[model samples]
Target: MRKIAILAVGFAPNQSEITETISLLISLSEFKAQFKIFAFDRSTPLNHHELYDLESLNPKDFDALVLPGGIGNATHLSTWSNDKIKMTVNPTVEKIIKQFYEESKPIGAICMAPIVVAKVLAKHNPNITLGENFSETHLVEGWKVTVEKCPSTDYITCRDTKVITTPAYMNDATPFQVFTGIRGLTKELVEMA
Candidate 1:
């Protein structure tokens, strides 16, 4: 079975993105893929949610990495002191992503999560999508990466790297559309694995 590690915000994450992605992957019983959730340490115990500490995980143990989209992604995953200011990329997340990239493992990002990917893989200048938004697109382009515009029903897979991205809620897509796109993303990542 292929092992996949999913990164989520330590605080309130996009529950829909995480749950739906896991559900779709689980539905694909034939793929024989196993998944686990990891979050950064907030210096407090997670009482309501069960997640492995991101620091404790070894990227080598997983076949692929997944980043689900949500408001928390921008606030919790990256090194942002406030909504208007981003200091640096999270070292742990950056290290994990770089390890996966160096290993040629696939990485998937959804919605606003692509911003984190763009920062982590800045030198690669990977082609990604975060739906059709002026500001978000501009932010990604600032990283020297190309941001492809995709409909809610479709996803963008980077040509030069094994990075996949979907707009998800960024386009205000219907739940059905988001599910279809995520399923497609999952299938692509599984194939890469």
Candidate 2:
């Protein structure tokens, strides 16, 4: 079985983190072996919700990296700082995420997760535009690029690159509806692995 990692930062009362967990699980169910979840907490704080810091875990053990979207990641990742207040765990997660990308492993980000990818790339290569507008809640900013056989409203996948973005409301969907897009990606991930 292929070992996969679903990376998360904070699970504070936010729609992005909650839906992202649901989306990751729903996607994993279609595969033979579910991914191992790792939550990262530099503060060593307790997460009322589990899987709050999945990204902070070591990436060497997994075949691919999955990032869940949220405003916390976007704001923390884009900015650089030495101050403790501004330098939170999410930024650390972003740095690790860059390492994952540099390793050339498959990464899956849904909804605003793509924003994390955009943010990292923006620091160096600002040429890539996600869309025209920016969202405070979701943290999506750039021209949207979609793929075939993916959810229209809540999901987009970079099939060639093995990166995915899901809608904010994806987890609210019925089980049948939720797995459609994720299953497709699962197949791709497994095949590539």
Candidate 3:
């Protein structure tokens, strides 16, 4: 089984972002895949949440990395808040992303999570999608990423790197649409693996 590392926010995370991808990956008959979740906050102990401390693990252990999008991603993965205009990406999360990039491992990012990808891969100017929101599209473009508007059921793969992205709930999509987006993201990552 291939192990994929999923990065999530420590606070109230969007459950669907993580659950849908995981469920679809497990249901695949073509390949067996397993996932390990890591959180941005290291101080919080794991409980009902299946998250492990991201700082404690080596990026080398996983074949690929996944970033699920949610409001928490803006709050925790980066320094963005509801009231803040300027945001700083978290150093720890940035470091992990850099490690994955250096290793040439496939990365799957969804919705607002592409913001983190854009921040880390600014030099590459990776082509990605974040749904149809014009404001969010401009936000990522400011970081030097090439934004492609895509439907919630589809995804965009960067040409220069092994990064795949999808717009989950960012499109005001139904649950089924979000699930299809995640499933497409997972399939692309698995193919890269």
- After TM-score superposition, what is the CA distance of residue 64 in candidate 3 from its true location, in Å? 0.4
The deviation in Å at residue 28 for candidate 2 is: 1.1
lDDT to native, each model: 0.75, 0.51, 0.75
CA displacement after TM-score superposition, residue 85 of candidate 1 (Å): 8.6
How far residue 129's Cα lies from its native spot in candidate 2, in Å, is: 10
Candidate 3 worst ten-residue window by lDDT: 11-20
TM-score of 2: 0.61
Ranking by TM-score: 3, 1, 2
lDDT of 1 by residue, 97-178 (tens): 8999999999998887788888888899999887876464665677788889887678899867899988878886787888
Summarize candidate 3's per-residue lDDT along 61-153 as a digit string, tens digits: 999898877777777788655533357788888899999999999988887788777778888888988788747567667767799999989
Clashes of 2: 13
- Model 2 Cα lDDT, one tens digit per residue, 148-175: 2235133444544555454443234454
TM-score: the better of candidates 1 and 2? 1
Candidate 1 vs candidate 2: the lDDT winner is: 1
Mind sharing the TM-score for model 1? 0.85
